[model samples]
Target: MIFPKILRLDKAILATGIMAVLTASAVGTAEPQLPALPQAVSSFGATVCDGYLYVYGGHAGKTHSYDTRSVLGSFHRLKLSAPERWEELPGGPIAQGLNLVSHKGKVYRVGGMQPRNAPGEAADNHSLAEAARFDPVKRQWEELPPLPAGRSSHDVVVARDLLVVVGGWQLRGRSHMPLWHESTLVADLKEQPWKWQAIPQPFRRRALAAAAIGQKVYVVGGLSPDGPEPRLDILDLARRQWSRGPDLPGKERAAFAPAACVLNGQLIVATNEGVLYRLLPEGKEWEKVGQASRKRQVARLLPWDEHAVLLLGGAGGGQNHDSLEIIPIPPRPEPTPEAR
Candidate 1:
């Protein structure tokens, strides 16, 4: 995670944030005040379902500092339509470096890393292979099929009827280095018995983001073995084929742990440097759409409504933030009469 130009970017985003607020006000677009999270965290899991934002476990301690108390198991949700407090919910194990996805009315949690040792003790974090789903009606989590092996630092998405787990690594223990995952996992949420199927992946990466547009799951940039990569790998569920899309904006250190989501039938990605780009519908190129007022990494980028997307709970300027920033999707200019 290389955060370049920290001080300069902080000032830039501060000025930009104010401008965005003023502009949104002048345009008469009714924007809701995004409520802050109860606690600041990073490497957490978040998903939006039925107009509510749900947050799960994350790393609460300082960077490079790990302990039993540092990793969290707290679960919370907020109503987006009405700005209010984060209602506490039933939480699972203390975990980090995983992602959450929403399906129907349920929220699912996938594999994550759990620390086994206590504070001041030698690090003994182990990756988990378990998966669970929270049912709103029942108000309880129902366990589902586990991964073939433990995985963490991965992103998950629901493509059609399938739940796909993207790039991540398996943390064995303190004595063993994390093993990067070389395959993608898929499970059918609609299947009577949830079963995980494995498919070969071209490379092993971690801290990436994934989203499904139509039936294709786009696995975006993250930290790779060679270093920070901007490659965009697309898995066409309809065809069961893998192909490459345009890489993210920058060449190196541009998109480590970046976040992405689908907006208005289009794909939008926000890199670590705060640049928000939209993938052209043709799937052959990318166009810069906007820049984030708050530059962050490893956060959840969720579509707020039809107009804007919310950037929530990520680390920026050397620390994790609970603040939420609303990034409005820039509307395309009306086509020229002659061109049309």
Candidate 2:
């Protein structure tokens, strides 16, 4: 796959004085700490709405197995100002592995899967194509038009006043092999019938992360047919075409289900390997910032504010984690006069 050219830092600028300043700044900055989740969860969806962080259906339990019984349909929210306290909201309609997005102060949940019987057997696994919107004020869910197909582990983002659902996987055949998708669907919320349109397919992958940086929507990091893909696909809304973005910097091609968000006009992505990357506005490359406190896969990254982001529940190193950690993205320090 063709990767975008990344701008390299000038070696001459890294003088001893400049290096010292960088070192000091790194040491002086405090590491942001994450608070524990109310319960252990993985394959869940989270978003910030109305000053509260909302977490929706996923696998929940102490043991980190894929048992269907572990799937939950409950909803919970935490006030950003007082994140320590969590209040349980009304239950949702679906089980785990759904795509959750917030639009116009309301939360929309789309597509998920659940086991058909007890013991959470894979043979009885069922993928859902239903869609619904939750009204926090009414404490109820309103059904919306279903997706063209049932999908799980997809990435959803709101761009151009539309809900864009990207690639994911669907169970097919007796062996139940995961078939990765290349379909891109968009929903127009203003119409009476809830118009849904299919756009040209991008790449085929599952467990990807997506975020809208501007007019364009960026789809990043997932398991491709060849293996874990490190490339980023950018969809230009105006031109309606797919283009490549900078490849993630690491020997590992892809980090499983990394979290992504747009903060302070920059695209911030955190991988399961625990590294955080930031893409500046109009930049061709991504810069490594710091590491997450915990290495997690299938985690949800929610932007808390301009300076802070919350890494929610996910599995790590074959074990599930209920821990919640906050990563602070401070402004880049300028070189001091001593460097000159």
**RMSD, every candidate, angstroms:** 7.5, 9.6
Q: Model 1, stretches more than 4 Å misplaced? A: 1-28, 333-340
Ten consecutive residues with minimal summed lDDT in candidate 2? Answer: 331-340
Kindly provide the TM-score of model 2 when superposed on the true structure, using C-alpha atoms.
0.83
| lDDT (10s digit) by residue, model 1, range 8-125 | 5778797877776876764467577777887888889999888789999998888767778999999999987787788999999999999889999999999998998999898899
In candidate 2, what are the lDDT values of residues 1-340, reduced to their tens digit? Answer: 2223222435555464465466446446444344577778888888988888888888775443444567788888887766667899887654676667898889988887765555644345566788888998998889888887778878889875788888887754335666666778887777777877877766888778898866678888888787887878988776778888888878555456788987665678998898999865445788887578888878888776656677889887666788887676766543111112
After superposition, the stretches of candidate 2 with alpha carbons farther than 4 Å from their true spots are: 1-35, 61-64, 120-122, 172-178, 332-340
- Model 1 whole-model lDDT (C-alpha atoms): 0.86
Residue pairs with colliding backbones in model 1 are none
